[model samples]
Target: MLIRSFDVLPAIDILDGRAVRLSGGKREAPTLDGGDPLRLAGRYAAEGARRLHLVDLDGAFSGVPRPELVRDVAAAAGIPVQVGGGYRTLEAIEAALAAGAQRVMVGTAALSATFVRRAVERFGDALVVAVDVRDGRVAVDGWTHTSELGPGELARRCAELGVVRLLVTSAARDGSLAGPDLPLLREVLPAGLPVLAAGGIASLADLRAVRDAGCEGAIVGSALLAGRFTLAEALATATG
Candidate 1:
């Protein structure tokens, strides 16, 4: 399948119903308002954003997803929403799907083999494993919990459980705007597993490097929101 397309997931980091950029992958830094999230999501939709990447800062931190808001965004926007944050239960996942989300992102729940297996079996490829990497190891729970499980091992296990998609993020480089750590991603490609690289993507060229490194897609948040690149520009250049 052609990985790169005229599609880029525009990110909207929702905290207290407003858009905020996490500094150093943190929730307690100066919260920035790119303004109302729903309005911004609509703008991106108008700009040809094929998908909306949304995170509930409160949910990611407190293990409580804002299903109402998730439903609101999905219902009001008329775009496919792929959400990640505190999705620990079947009910939460089902709620998201029922809310019109195209996919549900998995993170802390992956720590439990039973949960991972059940989720993959139940949801199939619609499940995305959110693998937060730090120094080539996996981090969990909003990047506050670090583990010795290497990326390749984690990737292998996730693929074994039938998860077709992986969302890989480098905690160290996140929101720094320096650049994505391609070297780190290259260090741990688990053969056939498809990965979407996230964190520290500063320019359109950064997205190209991600595709060249064999990632399925790249997620841009701060860079896109800050006008360094637009959704239309990024997606259009993803291939040519």
Candidate 2:
């Protein structure tokens, strides 16, 4: 995609290594996880998606990484898997890598700069830091952990800690299929870095909007997974 020089990273979230939808990115959504996540991952990869976003909803709720399931999806996907959700320990992070995750996203760990640096220094730039903002404040632990940290400060902290990319998702907009908050992106985004703007993306036009606002990509869940839009078509639209 000629999207202001930003790459669009398509999403493939897994609750139980199966395709499922979450309401507001919360676990309360009606489960449609009848299909295997491995198959879904392969589908996305076959569709020309370079990176895949997978979430361990069960693990997130349990405070542990489901190594077996994560490994299964990674092995099957044949592409880089950026896995996240419910990862809070060094052992968990290491296990995720050992399971073949190219990149591991940390939400709760992002709050502590030391932990982020530890993962980054050990794992390098592929280690992504997540900034899940609700009402402009950062939240973690499946959106249960609330913090007073502002987006700009958190982005700066993550950037300073050797994290190459910061993922900014609006909790309010998540899974609403409305759209991303561009004004917030423009205001809180740090210069000279890539911001993965996620949540509430419902159409190709929304992708263009995020690209126009200087976001590298978007994290689309409900819409894309439900077949409201196809990844290949979205890519064609974004790249077109």
Candidate 3:
């Protein structure tokens, strides 16, 4: 089988129906609006974005995904959309996928072996593990709660449970535009699993760095929303 090269995924995080970015995944952190979620998602599609990373900040913090927004973005983006945040139940997972999300990302719920096994059995590769790392430990509940589990161990377990992909993010680097935590990627890749990196990507160099680190994809947020780099430029760096 042929391996896929790195892909650049544009992010649209929704909070109160507006697109926003949060620093360190902190709910209290000041957020910057990128504009309407639906409009931004459409723009990403028009700009040659191959995939979209859509997050429900409200759901991540509150444990309920905004299904309406997920449906709208999936409909408008005209591309594969992976939706995450507060997906803790099979019903919720099915709802998001039914709403047109090609994949549903789960975090806190992944800590449960029973839940993960059942989810994988039911959703298979459509279920993506959102591995948010904080201080080298797994952080859940919108990055507010740090788990005692190491990321690599969690990843290994998820892979063993049949999860084909992981969306890895460093809470410390998230929304900071400081650059991706290459070391975290190194830690998680030992499972020989495919991963999509998120957070702390500031420039083309950062994008290239993640790609070289063996990430299958990178989810870009604040930097692109801040106009630090164009989506086109980032895509070039990922693909080139």
Candidate 4:
């Protein structure tokens, strides 16, 4: 397979200000404790992660963000941070960017075409839309509510709205570490946009598979925290 400029974004999902990884995106699901968020971010950066994917689980569920936490982590990581959770409005997106995020991901609010248009017009490349999938439909509200729109349709809309990139996740595979849903990634790839795959990324081979599937990047959480592979090994696999 031809190698590409694929990035490996080490993920830190914060719940109650501590690092944790949820199975299948469920808050109640079994979590792998990752200790302190700030420490993890710093460690990932030190280990050669090009970017950090930070999500506030509390903010995702409550529709309120903790910008202070984002600020602290972003500052400490010393690398570009992409933040998500509860960024459903222009104000919220702005706050996240102002708080030190290089990019802010919009999930539930991405359902509104008007909101997406406005956000794209305002933020441009700094905006990323999350197409979190469950049962072949888009899952919103922290993966609790399944929308009628399918991933392809939503992906096309995002592309049309001038969205610079997408973060695609399979709700079932998320944290399951079975493997990446390559068919789903293929389905969304036809939209003619760059996609970052998340969920079920368990090993160096999975990283290679995701890169071979033409993903721009992979957002890895559970496997990395579980010691399935180190970030250094993942980066080497992705670049090869």
Off-target runs (Cα >4 Å) in candidate 1 are 1-7
**TM agreement with the true structure for every prediction:** 0.94, 0.91, 0.97, 0.98
Q: Write the per-residue lDDT of candidate 4 for residues 2-52, one digit (tens) a residue.
A: 335999999999997789989999999856999999999999999999999
Highest TM-score scorer: 4
Residue-wise C-alpha lDDT for candidate 2, range 1-240, written one tens digit per residue: 123555566666666556776665677774345377788888888988878888887877778878887788888888888888888877888899899888888888778877887788788866878878887788877886678888888887776667787788887777677777887677556544678888878888888898777777777776776666888777876666
Colliding residue pairs in candidate 2: 1-239
- Residue 3 local lDDT, model 4: 31
Candidate 1 structure quality by residue, lDDT tens digits, 1-240: 345443457778888778878876688773356788888888878888778888887898888887887888886568888899888888899888888889999788887788989998899877998888876788878777788887777777887777788888888887778898887677556546777888888898898888878887788888977779878789887757
lDDT of each: 0.81, 0.77, 0.90, 0.92
Which window of ten consecutive residues has the lowest lDDT sum in model 2?
Answer: 1-10
TM-score, model 2 to reference: 0.91
Q: Given candidate 1, what's the lDDT at residue 3?
A: 54
Cα deviation at 141, candidate 1, in Å, is: 1.6
Cα RMSD (Å) per model?
1.7, 2.3, 1.3, 1.5
Candidate 3: give its CA RMSD in angstroms. 1.3
- Which residue pairs collide, candidate 3? none
**TM-score, predicted candidate 4 vs. hidden true structure:** 0.98
Q: Cα deviation in Å at residue 154, candidate 3?
A: 0.5
